[model samples]
Target: MTGEVAGGRVPLPQRTAEARLIVVARAKRAEDYDRVLDVLVEAGIRSIELTLTTPGTFERLPALTDRYGASVDLGVGTVTSEAELARAIGAGARYIVTPVTSAALVAQAREAAVPIVPGGLTPTELFASWSAGASAVKIFPAGQVGASYLKDLRGPFPDLVAVPSGGVDLDGAAAWLAAGAAAVSVGGPLLGDAFAGGDLAALGTRAEAFVSLCARTAH
Candidate 1:
């Protein structure tokens, strides 16, 4: 089940399928990024994504990685360029996720040996991303598509590892899992500003709720 990537050998799919809880924090300041990551780690959200929206994202990413990379699956989202990809990798990004699929970026991630989860909407986009070597396809704004859509989608593309992103919540997580999603990525809707605003206890509570729901559905 283990596969080799550019960075190193990634564990088998079974091990990676811990019903991920990816917290994507958006901000225009490094302080915000710090707050979100700190809370996420404390709340036990081991996988975190720092979207490239903050002014000092590049500088902050490495610092965060240096501090937490050993225990966290730190990654970057909304990545668009080869330079940005390199920067994220240098900063110790364990994975690369994008809002849109790009052949060049996917290729670079492959070279770096990091799993790339590129964004795709329609069936065409999903398959295209898979064909381009994407490890998983993120269905951005998946709220509009709904869990039933995934159920129907997997019927045809059974091997596709779909990750529904944007607007996913605890109550709805099970539906997505039952629909056959490999994992789910939630943003503000799950890890609200309270968590991003320095509320560790609240974040931890929310993390537990999310994990509970995902675990329940996974079985």
Candidate 2:
């Protein structure tokens, strides 16, 4: 990957390499993101992905981007189709993430100069996404494969840029980074119950903890 991403922006992979973290949120409703995101932003999270599974995300995304776009890389994830990708870009998604390895999506992102991180679980899938020009490939269900899975992958794909997502806790996040993961994309484990009206203070604490942990392990 190039040092500068398309559109002359810092590549998402570089941001993740430096921050070593990407916090993903899948709120039931779009309005719930405001408070949840405030806590994350305050905790110094630079990469944040809001999924399309949440209702009203496309409609409310523009405002969210307007509010936090400059300070953070506000992205859209769980993208499944060309229409959604178009809508995400129109709504100001700084980066695009998919649940599957798709070269088409990566090309689309390039057309808009938006970085794309496509998800895949197996080694072949992961390499395919990276080869297709994705900023990085997400290791979905990384917990099943464990942290060492990334290390093993590096044996064959020494320069592979990966972000382990799904079922990762604080320790698992550290483990992934230790194994050469570009970043750890954490969701439920890090979010806890923040969107379920859980404690924002507690959420902040967790976020801060992950941020500190990643910073300490960052290469």
Candidate 3:
């Protein structure tokens, strides 16, 4: 599906197709978040997910879009309400991600023609989200289930595009991809305690590593 925006039309599937890794950034301060984002973008990580939990995220969305939207497919995550969904779209988010499967939100995204990746852990929830027209289904806290879970899920629903988020590090990212995950969403592992006064350079190196891993193992 396509939706018209300031830049032009946005094709939902195409947007999801281009993202191999989505960096989830949540910082107490916007400046720190920006710093990490710069490092990630410089390391060739083009997709970013700014969580609503971050302070000033909604207020800063427009500026973020203006500055990096051209090169990065910026999106909003941890969304749970229609209001948040609306605000994200207005902020020019290329995609929407939720922590749980919300059929209503999925329908709203479908209407707007924006890609939505709703979180689900069970087969029922995942299938429901996909059936509701979500561009992809995100398996939250995937570390607990591991790559084996994803591979098993594909047995019943081979067509489902599964994205594993939370607790996913560079070491397991390729394994998830090999298990048939459409893409992987990484957070603290890639950030490397940067928000806790760690070195941004370390984060940059980690970003490069993740990007290279994705390249080598992309499905």
Give me the candidate number with maximum TM-score. Answer: 2
lDDT of 2 by residue, 63-108 (tens): 9878887777878899989889988988888788899988788877
On a 0 to 100 scale, what is the lDDT of residue 212 in model 3? 91
lDDT, residue 32, model 3 = 65
Query: Where does model 3 exceed 4 Å of error?
Result: 1-16
Worst 10 residues of 3 by lDDT: 4-13
Q: How close is candidate 1 to the true structure, as a TM-score?
A: 0.87
| Number of the top-ranking candidate, with lDDT as the measure | 2
Q: Give the TM-score of candidate 3.
A: 0.92
RMSD of candidates 1 onward, in order: 3.2, 2.7, 3.3
- Per-residue lDDT of 1-219 in model 1, one digit per residue for the tens? 113652332321332367456778777686666666666677666677788876677778878878777767777888988888888877777788899878778777776667788898899888888777777889988989899988888777887878899889876677788788888888876667653355667777888787777767664
Record all residue pairs in model 2 with backbone atoms less than 3 Å apart, i.e. clashing: none
- Candidate 2: count the clashes: 0
Candidate 3 accuracy as lDDT? 0.84
Error at 208, model 2, angstroms: 0.6
lDDT per residue, candidate 3, 37-117, as tens digits?
778889988888999998888888888878887788888999999999998988888899999989899888877888889
Q: Report the Cα lDDT for residue 76, model 3.
A: 93
